[model samples]
Target: MSVSKQADIAPTLRPPPALPADGMVISANFSVGGFSKRWNHCHQLANFLARYASANEDDPERHATLLSTFFNELLEAIYRNHGATGEIKMRFRKKQNHILVEAEVPINEQSAKFYNHAVQLANQPDPMAWYREQLEHDVPDDDAQALGLLELAVVYGSKLSISEPTSGDWLLLAIQFPFTEVEEL
Candidate 1:
């Protein structure tokens, strides 16, 4: 018998409370087309945000590159897992020594399950090993793999979580980076 670690599907995911404006905050919403219509939009948006966010870092150039890579990974996940029609909302906030990137993605049941499963795997005790196993094996359903979340959690010491389903079918996924370490890298 196989044991399953899937979470009970929630009716909706609630969005996080607005972060205080003590440091820097950037918020944007885009039509689904901005992502689905053109694939490169992910890279474009990621590069733009990363550059702006890393401007004051100790090693701005390297930090920008790191941010761009993770941001692109996140956008790619949204591009692949979103519903047919809905806006993609993004929030990036920096306060004290922490940085938070929150995304509200419109999702159907299928996509919700994908995110939930990914979160489960990312939070596992040996997520790095699981990530390596995934890289070595063949995963037919690539969208469900959640490789980006795993990489962020395992390699960068970022935290991955899902919370507050919107009134509609949406998943609020958050990736938090420890700014001190991120800048050092």
Candidate 2:
């Protein structure tokens, strides 16, 4: 079933399936990472992921920049939405024409619902308008966590999905980025 449809029917929405172990370019477990350093970590990880993913592209710099922007957005969303305690694991793999990112974060059932709601919003016909409305209006704290995914869908054209909760309270999230088109942006 589609991730959105699965989310609608299942109350235990969690993480995506494990990313293939063979293709990982980088992975990190942020269980002990200080919350104060999340901004730095997110940007640094994004830059590294972008650089590695864009190495063979024509305009490496442009592609890396674009990738970094979207990657940081994804990382920031995890930082904002994850539950209080658990390993936030992130893994990246390079595909033929895109980069696939899989993340498993500790999230409660309520947060899972919020994520599903955000995905639904992002899939709407006018996501950009909804994104603009989010920025212009004061949203509740829970809803504010939805903005990054919305921006990724609306502004960057990334594809996102979530898997059913597996093993524990972890929420699996998958994001696919078609980096080849970045140079033209």
Q: Which structure among the candidates has the greatest lDDT?
A: 1
What residue pairs clash in candidate 2, if any at all?
14-165, 14-171, 14-172, 15-171, 15-172, 16-172
The alpha-carbon deviation from the true structure for residue 150 of candidate 2, after best TM-score superposition, in angstroms, is 0.6
Cα miss at 22, model 2 (Å)?
11
The TM-score of candidate 2 is: 0.74
What tens digits encode model 2's per-residue C-alpha lDDT throughout 124-148? Answer: 8888887888799997776687887
Q: Tell me the whole-model lDDT of each prediction, alpha carbons only.
A: 0.78, 0.75
Best by the TM-score measure: 1
Model 2 superposed RMSD (Cα): 15.7
